[model samples]
Target chain A: MIDKILSKYPFPESVKLEIKEELEKLNLSADKIKALVDRCYKAYTQNLMEPEEAAGIVAAQSIGEPGTQMTMRTFHYAGVAELNVTLGLPRLIEILDARKTPSTPMMTIKLLPEYAKDREKAKEIANKIEATYLKDIAEIEADIKNMKIIIKPDRKMMDVKELKMDVLKKKIEKSLKVDVFEEDEKLIIQVEPSYKKLIDIFEKLKDLVVAGIKEIRRVIIRKEGDEYVLYTEGSNLKKVIKVPGVDFTRTLTNDVWEIYEVLGIEAARNAIIKEALETLEEQGLEVDPRHIMLVADVMTVDGELRQIGRHGVAGEKQSILARAAFEMTVNNLLEAAIKGEIDYLRGITENIIVGQPIKLGTGDIEVTYKFGGKR
Target chain B: MKVRLQDHILVPKHEILSKDKAEELLKLLGITREQLPKIKTSDPIVKEIGAKPGDIVKITRKSLTAGESLFYRLVVD
Candidate 1:
């Protein structure tokens, strides 16, 4: 019956092979296995087959013979039914047909506290203490030990406020229990041992202030000769000179100058050159913006402004598009103005034809045109 | 010739037995607990229905080749 049932279903060849091997190991005759398969096949078609039905057939046929102790366990649970088969007989066959194996290499690490003497035990204790307590020491080492003090007055005065500085220093010392020292223009406070955490807090505050200032201010860059320049609008030359690494000699300052006084001379020159091109583009010209910038950089001598074009510094490498495009843009703008004038005249003519009084002058005006053969 | 007859034990077929009753039944059959394998807590079917430990799971076995067979109900906690 089981064999007939197995034949009706399209069981995979692997599963069929497994069943055949199990039957052979159980010493069951081919005819007996065929008869069991036929019975299972009949049950499946009749809808009388259950999960355990298949399991029990496999179990009884395989384990009923001698030396075969297979067990089929079935479970009905809240979720779904399940069947499990234990191959005790096949396991015994494997054990009889098995081979021996060898071991492999390994390593281990062990602490030697048990074998330690007095000094070694003390050293181990200290190491353990450091491991547990000194986890944050390395991270705290980067914070500044001294506070950086900055002072700026709302209004400028010839005399410095020495008393105010002394009082401020005293107040900070009293509140934080830290030593305050005055350098040339700044006050530095040494961080106390108890307030080491404040070092990181203060550093973070400084970073935030600096970032805020940078965000509020608009700094632009330009190219001058072989270098770049940095400049901020409406800033004094002295303010620009204060920036480190600047070459002050090459910097120019006229009423309408394009020189950068900050950082290296090359940087200043670049800023001026970039600004010159931007100025030209702002005039609604069609010059390739990059060409104007490059020409400005090459034309400027030692950061001094110089004109660039056919008769100027870049005459040898003049571009026809640069000149033609500039001319065409100017002409187009002029044409637009003339069209506007024509539209104005047409509007006046339409108003007159409709017999409306054309508002010409604000005050009383003389009648220049003959209306109804003049009065 | 006179024949002696033994009284048959009456069993309720419709009464569903709990895990404790099943254990009592197994005791009557002279079977040890080790003879029955346990259902693991991590079994997919048990977890799918949210069955916890100490819950009884019943199974019915019907085989065409060997006819009706006995099965075990697991205590899945």
Candidate 2:
């Protein structure tokens, strides 16, 4: 049935086959499928990149033109305290640079259907997400004369976080290997009677985890549209996904590297594009998604996340001259010569450096004439 | 043990194309394995399906802007 409709149009074999496959996927009846096919065929024909078209240059211009209008500073998430998200130009640069850690790492967590509707469950989730330190829930005072640390438990804070004083004392004792004594309102931790040891012990006491997950410093659950979504200041994609009521499939971290670690290269590629476009869009700048996709593709074609600039994608180019043209010119050239590396002279940068047309579009093809002509 | 790549957010729908289907695809496209996009043999999904180097893998993905799209890759070591 698809073949019959597709045969009516004098389309390329590839186009006809692709249209047929797409129509089958649409799963429409014969008449509807044919109509959709015609529409798709029209769209495809209109969208074809022309022969000899410089796609790379066009993509660069498309993204770079709108980028100039982007705002410079980060944007803070509304209602979230000091939850500043890196946006606009800086964030775009960060994504392309493939920074090891984002300036402001965050997670957008969705909950399971049951938990999504309940306010109480969302609060519970928020509490679990907010990392709790002993210093946050207790008043600690170091007595130099006695060589001891007194930790006065904040009963309200402990109660709110659902933490037990006894459990906190046990954890401190195990981790710090200090003698902990339970008093009426305060827990006394006996420290070694040396100035240096006492100082060391006092420092370790400050960062002890009293309750809740680590890494996630703050979490705010807000109702967007209908469901309660969690916006966290810190991110731990691997651990957060393990939480019982989380909609694991939909939860995402803004940190591309973290996404790469948890979800692999393909997801990282998508994250890079998403992050770049979001940054641009936040500042009311618009660029084609195809351009962003091309950038993402270049960054991840090797099955690994790589930055666009030096120390990553640029530095690792197969052509030595191309690498040298990017940065550290002398160093690159010297290293390449030392290694007896051969330049393929295939890439755009290398070809352009020698004042030749780049191997793209028309430049990518070659034609040779035979001495004898066939009759 | 390694985590399943199928659970990855952008892995898409991966299938190991049978020999006959792969041959037919190559004929239809008028291209060789070298011309197709490359997927590393070490890639988690490629490994998950137990595809060796030189085998063809078909990937179908839902693009936000382009709807459903298909891609082919030659698994390479």
Candidate 3:
């Protein structure tokens, strides 16, 4: 689908050929160029970078001197790093073309003894040991065990000790279920039974510190009168909402959208109704925008607000009498009434004929029969 | 085949020929493959005619500016 859209766009063949040649000169494959283009496209659509920024990077590599290779390399490296984080190693592993099967192939082990003399003697001892130990251990493996570990860092000469303590703490955390604490000149670790196997795994992974994986942050917006109030926990709402045209007044309150925008939608919906109600009271006249929110929510899908035109809001019911009278007199009368005019004589007469209390859109509330029932 | 030569340039009977004829002409000429420029799959000119890889494309060479020559690509399949 994306290819189809790109096809319509008129990129000059000469330019494309030049780009291809440039890529060839750099020893980059067509696939790599495509991947870079895909990253640029994603960044462009996500509003992360301008099209010019993507184009500048592409053009610079294509026409600029070899000295600019460093900049190009940096751009590609940044793109790949982001891509790796977005599609984590586990996902990439699953999609790897080399992996035909889901399960990894097991390594076969062959043990050799040190010497011929010791080999025969070791075999006999191993056979006897395996017969007794392996049989009992295999049978007892069905039992489950629980264990815990706590870790503490050292104080006094803290700076030097801190580095060593962190390394040790990470090692313990990786290998076992452990908690760490900082104390004077020592680090304490508490460990559990299941963590025993992980001790070696952590030792290996200690050097591999994964960086650049970003946690998605959300923003919340609350409707206050004619404007939206934005907030987020642990974030400076005052500073963030300073975007031009956005109004921010801090008071004790919550709105679903505001919460959703700041802390994610699920948290906003799960907000306690009681707490919301109390907050609404505290911030008077700022009714838990939830009332309008509920109406709007029911009328919308995926949280997008649709406009309520002259015909009334979508997915809402109109009265039978209103619907019937809509074509003839009601439309004009409603328009006039909206303009603040009242014809009491016509209203009472219509009420008597319709055999119902006529609802008027204008003036003071007083029911008076000013005309006979014949229209 | 008796080929007519006008002013030392080869001239064929047909004014325009199909892809088969064009390929045959290129083969008849002593020109190497690299002399002919490659067209990319993503090229808009290739897309305009809905051509894919391995398809023969014909373009007219013209000079628009005083010193700049541009290739105006026509039909492709």
Candidate 4:
């Protein structure tokens, strides 16, 4: 049936195969399948990029034109209160800029099948993943006379964070290197007699991450569909991917650099494309993902994430005039002049600058009429 | 890390080509070894697949423009 449709409509294999799969699931009649395939074929044909078409400029304008309409706001992500994500133009710029870290880095973590549906198990995972500072789960004070830093772990909060007293004690002991002894329901760290030493211990202990990965500031367990999903306030993909009970395969983070570091450049390129498309889609703008893919390919083709702006892609252009046109016009032109640079006039921007037709689309062809075809 | 590179959604399919296959691919694309994209020897996927320097890695990714697309990279230090 699919072969019949394919032979008639000339559908791409991928699209045709996908349609056939959906049709099989539907138990559709033969005529119905053909009609559906026909409609899909039309849609596919319309979307195809034309030969010799200027895709780069079209992609730029496709994304650039709609980008103006996006609001420059940090949206409350997915209606999850207090979780602010940089959206709209700023985020698009951030992705394109290939910033080392996103202004608001976050993760969407999936749990293993057993832990995914249970609120308790999900909370446990969330607590284990979230960075829990001593200040967040305990009360601390400097006893002036005794030269001691007293930490009183909140029983209720500790329980909620799934933290045990001994585990907390060991972590605190390991980090501070001072033996902790319990006195009157408080953990005490003896410091040197100097007032400065007491102050030092107090400050140091205050910010100690007694539980979980330090980079993950907060992990909220929100029920998404049938499973509880972990949405994080801050991202720590490297550490998070290693945590037990996390469906490591399904975990996602917005830190492209982190992805590059942990997963390599291929993954980073995919992230760039995925991130840019999401940013555009979130703003209710419809831009072909291919445009974003083209941009991403440029940014990551060299196996390193290079920004789209002056410090990266534009700055490194082969054509002097193109680079000069992008930014730092004086600096680029002056440097080119001093170096006796050659302008090939091969690139679109350089050709346009010299008042010549760019070697693109129709301009690329010198003769409209070809030599007569052989009989 | 407990995660396998293969399991990561962002990572595309990567396979190292034999010397003869690599030569064919380069010739087919009408490009030199230097012209192909470079993937660092230290890259996690490169390390995972045990691809050495001068090896050509064929990457197949589910692309947005075409349903699937092919990419080649020169493994470099």
TM-score for each candidate, following the candidate numbering = 0.16, 0.84, 0.15, 0.86
Candidate 4 stretches with Cα past 4 Å from truth are A1-12, A18-51, A162-166, A179-184, A337-340, A366-375
Q: Could you tell me which 10 consecutive residues in candidate 2 chain A have the lowest summed lDDT? A: A73-82
Question: What are the runs in model 3 whose C-alpha is more than 4 Å off?
Answer: A1-375, B1-77
Residue A158 in model 1: shift from native, Å? 33
- In CAPRI terms, where does candidate 3 land? incorrect
Residues A112-226, candidate 3, lDDT per residue (tens digit)? 2231134343333222211121111111111123332222222332332223445545644564445655455343433345565446433433332211001112223333343
Leading candidate by lDDT = 4
User: What order do candidates take by TM-score, descending?
Assistant: 4, 2, 1, 3
lDDT of 1 by residue, A1-375 (tens): 335545656444445555656666676665777776566546545664342233322432332343332322221121111211112333222211211110110001111234122344423322221111111111112334443333332112202211244554464456455565765544554454545555553454333211112221333333333334433223233433332333333333221221222222222234433333332233333333333333433543322333333334333223332332334546544655665533232222334545655434332245577668845
Worst 10 residues of 4 chain A by lDDT: A72-81
Cα lDDT of model 4 by residue, A1-375, tens digit:
767766677665577678878877998778888888778888887888766799888888999899989997766564577788888899889989988999999999999999998999998889889888999999999999988888999999998887888888899889988899977778998887899878888899889998888888878888889999999988888888788999988899998988999999999999998998888888899998878888988888787889998999889899999999989899999999999999888899988888988788887777655679776
Docking outcome class, model 4: medium
Model 2 regions more than 4 Å off = A1-43, A75-82, A370-375, B1-11, B18-57, B73-77
Q: What is candidate 2's CA lDDT for residue A277? A: 79
Q: How big is the positional error of residue B20 in model 4, measured in Å on the Cα after superposition?
A: 2.5
How many pairs of residues collide in model 4? 0
Chain A TM-score from candidate 4: 0.84
lDDT of 2 by residue, A115-205 (tens): 9999999888888877898899999899999988899989899889888878988989998988899999799978777989988888888
